[model samples]
Target chain A: MNLLSIIKRFAYDLQGLTFYSFRLFGKILSRPMYLMETFEQMYFLGVGSLFLVVLTGVFAGQGMALQFSIELADFGSKNYLGRVMVIAITRELGPVLCGLMVAARVAAGITAEIGSMKSSEQIEALRAFGIDPIRKLAVPRFWALMVMLPVLTIVTDFVAIYGGYIIAVYIANISGAVYWTNVTAKLTLGNFIIGLSKPFIFAAIIAIISTYMGFSTVGGTRGVGRSTTESVVACSISILFINFLFTRLLVPQIQGLL
Target chain B: MIRFENVSFSYGKEPVLRDVSFHVKPGETVVVLGISGSGKSTILKLIAGLVQPDSGRVLINGHEMTTASEDEWSRVRPKIGFVFQGGALFDSMTVGENIGFTLIEHTDKTMDEIEVTVRETLRFLNLSEDLIDILPDSLSGGMQRRVSIGRAVAAVDPMIMLYDEPTTGLDPISTEAITELILKLQSVKGVSSIVVTHQITDAFEVTNHFIVLHDGVMVFDGPGEKLVQVQDERVQSFLAPFMQSVKNIPAVCPEE
Candidate 1:
């Protein structure tokens, strides 16, 4: 398509997303909350993802610590590796990595499930029964993700710090007490706020974006596949862009206040 | 009762329905016949208030849907049950859960009461209670359709039933069973219905009242007997192929 047409299509999609998101927000607070479904999703989106998150955290932290220690050693500052690694993991790497990874896994799954429902006419069936599909399906998943992602991020953050310790003290020959002290001393309340808060924002955006894509699905099984793909791509890009936006907008104000 | 007056609809610029006017009375069954892409299912969607008409009025029990708010539509929607072509059972849910979905969502019935109602609905639909706890995907095509019907009626017991291609892509036995259920729902339950199907034989078996649509236009609206007599080129062509196939069948076995 031409640039003009692409721009127009993007505008159209944004308008649709805005309307769908607002309607979903209304249902998120409506009565007759589906508590069981939310808990089930918590099991699926949160607990189900524990192993993957831990594995990601370990590898990421190990790699960062290894590279940082090697560079700092050349300058005779290797002892500061723990402090720098902790700050990086908590302030930036932890949230963004966790958000992107969960966005890929959870967002894709939600889109595929709901897209299949949309294609199968189950969504329409829900409506014909006077039951809101958004309230029934999306609301539960939305709330579950919002509650689960921060908890997952916390797990990722601690595990990553531990992973850094393993690499620094054992592999890099740094003292364990010094490393632990530096890691703990570097973690500020503001850093924790930023770390925990990004996951919540990511969770909300991912939930809404994925559900919106699912609802917009047309065609059939192929359409389900298309929407699932679109949602994963959209969600990953959104997480990155929004992470940058959050850092640019919030970090300064938070630091200034501190 | 459901009524549509000069209703027109389009997806983008491609008109799916145009100036269509028809009414289904209480306890009456009106079968809408059209070929593929002829806007047959669109009529049922309109009746269920799933889509809005661009230029005309749709009334459900004297409530004009064109100007009605979403709250008003919600109040009107429960009186109708939609059985989709593929059954559309929530595959993630067991058969009992699927049947009990509307009840759980809309009614104040306790879990035990809902279980009782689901069992009764399964019995009502002639399905084995053994199938209740199994996922709908594990069931056969015909069984899934029956479970969908059970789900539709298990809840508030909607007075109006909407069936879209109720027997498409089914074996003859399953086709017969669904037609029988449709007839039973009409006569036994006294539920008003608007059935949309391309299966002329199935439509004829279920209802004498008919509405024929072609190219987004209503070609014929009358009884089965009158539909057979319609001579409009579009109407004749639509009915002739099916009628000829029936007529071409030999009366006796070829082995004889």
Candidate 2:
């Protein structure tokens, strides 16, 4: 298929899966809630994702610092490294990159595990036993990512800035006070908020797309691989696209209100 | 207790089941025998309300599966259990956790009570206590099957047990063990069963009634022994291959 047709097919499939997920979600909360299952999913989707987020945070911090300091050093303004590092990390890299990392780690894991369960008829077995798969499996993980992603991004943003600051001051021989002053002067609450905001939506998108892909994955190992690939690619693209749109729509309004 | 009347289903437009009609009376064990793609397992899904029929109706205890409310379906579902082909144990969970999943999800049982119940059920399945804490990924095929069966039984006392190709991947010994377990569950649990399989001996050993589907249509409905003596030429041709291969398998007794 051509690119346009592929996009159209993807949109249609995504819309249908979204509708199905919401419908099942409604049923999940109505009665006979799987409270324990939800808790279990939360642990799987949230607690297990910590190390990945932390690793991404540390690496992103150090890398951004190194790149920014090198660039600023040419202009004899290496002291401004912290300001650039903070802005890029918080407002762009923190949420977006962290979301991508999570999309790669947790989203793929969710998709593969759930997809395997689905192909193996374990989902059908759940239905046969009076359990709603959404309530028992999907929603908790969905909400877990939805809740955890933003928090993880915030942590990543802080860690990244700190890592960058440490590298700029100690390794790159920039003055600590100058770096602090530049970052503090350029950085605002708005930037932090802006950076942190995207993760909730990003998390939601990742959870929805990944869960849907996993739940609907057909065939065997090939199918699981395809779904996992689709999940990461689709989630990352959606996160960036929506981040741009959200910035255009919400950022101006928030600036106006402030 | 379960019935399908003129039910039709298709995946996208290719028909998988066409005008299929069958019924399992209360507490009766019905075996559905067919070649792959014959819509045998689809019947279980139809009855369990997993897939809505494209046409006609599936009635479980006089309520249409498609029209039943969520509450109604939930109320009905607990009365049935499905054991899938590959055991389908939650890989991340231990054997005890997998079995206690249903109890934990749907019941108000305390941890202590659930632990007791899980231990009791494991013992009932002749599983060692040491197996309880091991992850499902560590379990053998027969052990996995037992754990899956244990999970299915944990929710409530199922009045109907559905087995979808239970013996598909097992060795002869394991197959015999599963077949005997199916029989024991029927007799001891006093539950109805609908098993879909290609294994003739499995059909003969566990099910009293047999339903055969050919090309998505019900071709025969009778006792298990009658399958061997059916006058239908198509049925005879279908059995011809199994009959030829039956000699290769020794007439071993059912596993304990």
Top model number, TM-score? 1
lDDT of each: 0.89, 0.81
**Residues B29-102 of candidate 1: C-alpha lDDT, one tens digit per residue:** 88899889999998888888788888899988887888888899888787788999899999999999999988
lDDT of 2 at B129: 79
Scored against the native two-chain complex, candidate 2 gets a DockQ of: 0.72
User: A1-258 in candidate 1: lDDT tens per residue?
Assistant: 899999998999999999999999988887879999999999999999899999999999999999999999999999998889888999889988998889889999999999999999989988888878899889999999999999999989998999999999998999999899898888889888878889989999899999999999999999999999999999999999999999999988888887
Q: Model 1 Cα displacement at B93 (Å)?
A: 0.4
Interface RMSD score of each model: 0.9, 1.2
Candidate 1 chain A: 10-residue stretch with minimal lDDT: A188-197
Q: Which stretches of candidate 1 lie over 4 Å from their true place?
A: B245-256
Question: Each model's DockQ?
Answer: 0.79, 0.72
lDDT of 2 by residue, B1-256 (tens): 8888899998888899999888888878888988899998888888788888889888877777778887888888877888888888877788998999888878889989999999988887878978888998887898799888888887689988988888887888888878878877887888888999988766767765878888898899986456677889878877887876544323432222
Off by over 4 Å in 2: A1-8, A24-55, A66-79, A171-173, B244-256
